[model samples]
Target: MYETLASVDWARLQFAVTALYHFLFVPLTLGLSFIVAIMETLYVRSGDEKWKRITRFWMTLFAINFAIGVATGIIMEFEFGTNWSNYSWFVGDIFGAPLAVEGILAFFMESTFFAVMFFGWDKVGKGFHLLSTWLVAVGSNLSALWILVANGWMQYPTGMAFNPDLFRYEMASFWDVVLSPVAVAKFLHTTGAGYVTSALFVMGISAWFLLKKRDVVLAKRSMVVAASFGLIVSLYVVLSGDESAHQVAQKQPAKLAAMEGIYEGEKRAGIVGFGLLRPDKQIGDKTSPFYLDITIPYALSLLGYHDINAFVPGIDDLVYGNAEKGIRPAQERLDSGKIAVGALADYKAARKSGDAATATAALDTFNAHVGDFGYGYLEKPEQIIPPVTPLFYSFHMMAGLGFWFLLLFTVTLYLLMVNDITRHTLWLRAALLSWPLGFVASELGWVVAEVGRQPWAVQDMLPVHIAMTDISGSSVMITVFAFAAIFTLLLIAEVRIMLKQIKIGIEGGH
Candidate 1:
């Protein structure tokens, strides 16, 4: 059992490393594509060679980031087959559909247009070149949309039915999966973060140029575009985040509880504005969860349910049951899930033995408790609660950084347009330093989303251990170290290349 767990842990670590590394580039790619398109559009409208120079300068950076992002993304996809074959087999019918569309349609379109956008500036007509750039941007976002749709389906597991005979989930409604509310909210919120990331990247670089007193006019214009774009999308991020929280409350209450460090169920739950979780806190303990905290009154209830007085269940409520809240205990689900598991085995056995009536009865029993099937694999009810400390910190950090980005964009924009932004040396320095925070916030948002839904590969349906491929622990461990080294080198290379380009300055632009 320990060996099995070790193997699973290694596999998880490997995937996490790849995923986090890959994501470091994804958000920037998503946002920078559109920003470059917008810049080129400006160049076309006014026939301004300065706008063209700005477009080309940023586009060079975007192209470098895009190439590395594609490489990492493709490697991450191959890991699904290599490390998570069981999960792939179990939900491939439902999950693979969106990925296929992303690869075949979105990725193809993006790749094709990206060439024309990058190389067609002088060779092609200005209008056609601008169209290609816009197409590339649209294609990049469409790729994200499809990928998020698949991920959101994992979180919610909607529009699918379990096939007992096949021992897998099959897609029941394509449109339902595509247009799922969870999918929509996740895509919008995630892309909004991406937009803000690119804006910060642009503003930060621009600020650096200003501080160095090189290309003052270009720096100011870039700052204005980035600040305006960042400020608007920052609002979208917040609004979409609220909807995401509400969805979590409705669909995955355990994750919501873990995020807030809630151990006892309550009405009118207050959100922790900033809190340090007590190291010794445990489920059903009498001790307070936090060491020191400030909480806004009823904010959690409002955010979770769009109501100020909604009852928010905690980790204890989810694991031990809250009869008053009509929440069933994990133990009950575990028992039911075991029964379902037994029924499935019995059904398969009876079918093999050519006993039709027995198989029918077993199938009926399995269907009755299929909702708790994943719980059957768990050793204890406590497993339902995710890592509270990580979720709590990740959620707060993401939220705090988000608000800061909004403020930075607002203040930066105000200063740029109305006042002389270049005069504010302190603010320029702050802007330059704050760009990395966008990447940090983006990563934390993913940590909150992915880590918050622990244990389950597909929420409520497939646990992570059960979903792992049957591979040796040493094999996974070796790959983990290997990938870590490779990804680190790739990151260093991209950074060095980008810095070299930035050092060369906009004078290098065509």
Candidate 2:
């Protein structure tokens, strides 16, 4: 047996693996680029040799990460066409447009300027090079915007129509897609995360330098910058993340429920503590049952409703909500019905006064009943479908890491600023050693977000089963293994290079 089940599962695993790996580099690139720009600007303004040195050191790491990010991201895009051909075809009109915009507006802009910023040290003027660097940062973030705009549309589809003639969804209005609430929130949340990611990365490396007693002035300066950025981003992450969660509550209740591990309606759902996310209703005591109870009774309510003790829907409600007798009964059919009725009313008023094409299209929609919503309406219990253990733990782990980073970074930054950064060498050494943890948290955060939305690759709109192409499991497996090997080697090489570079400082030679 070629493992038929593996084909479907394999694609998901590969996607999760690759996306997680790629994400590890993305935030660092985004954050590092901006910080590098800032460092370069400081250099340009003051003509300081130290700023130049700082920029060069950081740029080396940024370049390595950027290369890996681009390489891995290319694979994801290719996988869309190859592995997710059906998803591409079905939502191509609606989904493809944003991706196209990303390609044209974000990717090209970033890549073009990035080359200039990176390679044109001698060719471009100092100011022009700095401008190029900033543009690269802008372009990178813009890339995120378009991609999120598309993702936001997916999160909450807006201003789109199902064209029966084309057998796909089409954009009704560009502006509708742009102003989507989910996209807007996610863009802010993701951008903040990028800044935080880079800040923590810088903090970690700088801490290492301090621990080594290598360069006090430079290390302290880097710490100040990183900490300041980290503080702003951390606070913003919590605030914006809350807003994003509310958006999820409105748009994707099922996912929100999954995050909270709430399988049934609760008047006062607690903020979940680390424990078993058993949706089977079989873990602890049946009544008032949660594995390790330390929940804020009205936290979920507050998050979703700005009120205490609000009724939050569980997985059951979401499942029933999508059922045949439930809500969300093929939006296309509903639209078609409304259009047909309106057309009939118009025809009755004045058959000769109207354009025949409008009535004809309405009649076609009503008569043809063209929209085919596969099995998305059917929702099953978590008990029925076993959760991926990796995804389950990954989500919790990411959440855990986020809280940890927020807590530790806050305390340490406060301590460092109040007392001298060098005075608390233990903390600095700890922070230096722990720099990788921030990136780890980020990687895990992405893993949780992407993997938790599993079984349905394109959120709730399209199932992964139907979306995947006719690719063999063996082929996907080969690439999966190949990526693992290549990425591992690259990671080692990157760390080694960064370590060596860190040793070299303001006076120049180590």
Candidate 3:
């Protein structure tokens, strides 16, 4: 038991470290590509050499981020084989398809057009060059879309059926997987956040220029573009976030309960406006667990269900059950799961002994309750629950930062429109200082999403500890430290290069 626990923790830590590092570069790529496209478009429309220089400068930064992001991304693919081989095989049929399409279609196109957007500035026609830049932007987002689709499937696990014969899940409908509501919502929210990150980045640097009294014309123009763009998309991100929350309520109630820090079932649960989630709390352990909490009445009910009167299940309700809320006791699922697991063992034994008829009969019974297969491994309902501490705080941090971004962009947009940001030194300095908030908000949002769904690698279908490959704990621990060290070195190199380029200023582009 100790060895198993240690292995799971080490493997999870390794993957989490890799994922967090990779994401740092992704949002910038998402937002900067379009910003670069917009700049290139302005250059093409006005035939202005200054606009051309501005476009080239941002594009150079975009290229650097893109290259580093890609390098870091490759390790995740390798991690799947090395650390998560069991999971890879279990749902390879369903999960592998989106990844395959992303590599063949989105990634190739992004790389191809990216070269043209860079070196072909002089070699290609002006029209073709502009087209290439737009293509790169589209390709970058398409890559995001497919990756989200794969991730969304893991969250929801729809459009697939378990295959007893193959002992794996197979795709039931490709389009269903591709067009999942969860996937669509995630794509919008994620890309929207990326755009927010880019806008903040541009606005911050432009604000820095204003403070330094350098390149007034270019800096003001950049600020206007970023402020306008950020305003519209920040609104979209919040809306999409609400939609995402609604979906989570429907599909992942335990995660929602954890995020909201709900301990007991209620008809009209309040949304926690501010709270310090106490460490000692657990499902069924506390009726009111918070150390400090401020709530907006019925807000959680309305936000999660779109119905003010709807009942929201708490952690205890999710673990045990609430008959009034239409929730079945988890023990019932566990009971059925044991029978199904036994049937699978019987089938395997019969097959080994060359009894075709017995194998077929046992297989039929196993398939009947295959949906509860993961439950069979658990001894009790508490085994289904994830760690609530990270989920609770991460959600708040993400939400708080999101609102701050909206206010920052809205105020900055107004200032840019009035063309009087130079008059407000404090506001300009705040903008320059607040560049990292977007990255913080973005990472926290992911932490809430991924950590909230803990225990399960594929929701209720597969637990991550069970799904991870059979590897020694020490080996995983060794690899975890190695990856952390290497990624830290690369990140330092990237930050230094970016700072040097930015320090050189707008003149560096020419």
Candidate 4:
């Protein structure tokens, strides 16, 4: 059991490392693609040579990031087959559908025009080049749309039914999976965050140019576009984030509870604005949950349910039943799940022995408790509760950074339009330093989303231990180190190349 658990942990670590590393490039690719396209569109419309130079310079950096992003991304898909074969077998029918479309349609569309957009500057007509650039932008986002759709389905597990004979989940409604509200909200929120990251990257680099007193016109123009774009998408991020919180509260109450560090259910629950969780606090303990805290009254209730007085279940309320609130205990679900697992084994055996009557009875029993099937694998009810400290801090930090981005964009835009932004050395340095925060904030948002839904690969249906392939712990550990080393090299190469291009300035493009 220890060896098996170690192997599972190692596999999880490997995937997490690869995913987090790959994501470093994904948001930049998503945001920069559109930003570059917009720059080109300006050049096409105004027939300005300076716009063309700006477009090409940014496009060069975008290309370098895109290449590295694609390389890292392909490995993540393959890891599904290598490290998580069981999960693939269980949900392949449902999960593979969108991935297939993403690769065949969205990926191919992006890759095909990517060449035209990057290399066809002189060979293609101005109109055709502009069209290709927009297509690349559309294709990149469309790719993200399909991928997020697949992930959102895991979070909510909609439009799928288990096939007892096949021992897997099958898609019931393609459109239901495609048009899931969770998917829509996740796509919007994730892409909006990516846009904000790209805007920060551009604005920060432009700030560096202003500080250095080089390419003043190009720097100012880029800042104007980035600030305007960042401000709009930042607002969109807030709206989409709210919808995502509501979805989590409805579908995964434990995660919502963890995010807010709530251990007791209440009406009009307050949100912790900033707090240090008490290290000694435990479930059902008399100790206060926080050492120091500031909370906004009724904010959590309003945010989670769109009702200021709605009851929000905490970790305690979820794990051990809340009878008055009509919430079932984790213990009950675990019992039901165990019965379901046993019935499934009996059903398979009976079918093999040609006992149709017994098989039918077993199948009925299995179906009755299949809703909590994944819980059967859990040894304790506490497994349902995710790491509260990490989730709490990550959620708050991500939110705090979001507000900062909004302020940065607003102030930067205001200063540039009215006062000469170049004259403000302090603000320029702040903007330049603030670029990496966008990446930090994007990573934190993901940590909150992924870590807060711990122990389950597919919420309430498939546990992570069951999803992993039967592999040795030492083997997985070696690969974990290997991937870390390789990814680090890739990141270094990207940064070095990008810095070289940035050093060359806008005139280098001409």
Model 4: how far is 246 from its true place, Å?
1.0
Range of the 10 consecutive residues with the lowest summed lDDT in candidate 4: 1-10
List RMSD in Å for every model shown: 1.1, 6.1, 1.6, 1.1
Candidate no. 1 TM-score:
0.98
Query: Per-residue lDDT of 457-477 in model 3, one digit per residue for the tens?
Result: 998888888788888889999
List the candidates' TM-scores in order: 0.98, 0.83, 0.97, 0.98
Query: What TM-score does prediction 3 earn?
Result: 0.97
lDDT string for model 1 (434-494, tens) is 9999999999999988998898999989999999988889999999999999999989999
Q: Model 1 segments beyond 4 Å from truth?
A: none
Model 3 ranges off by over 4 Å:
none
Q: Write candidate 4's Cα lDDT for 1-510 as tens digits.
A: 445589999998998899899889999988998999899999999999999999999999999999877867777788899889999999999999999888886658998999999789999999999999999988999988999999999888989999999999999999999999889889999999999999999999999999999999998999998999999999999999999999999998999999999999999999999999997888877567999999999999999999999999988989998999999999999999999999999999999999999999999999999998999999899899989999999999999999999999999999988958988999999899999999999999889888887889999999899999988899989989999999999999999999999999977863
**Number of clashing residue pairs, candidate 4:** 0
lDDT of 3 at 260: 88
- What local distance difference test score does each model get? 0.92, 0.70, 0.87, 0.92
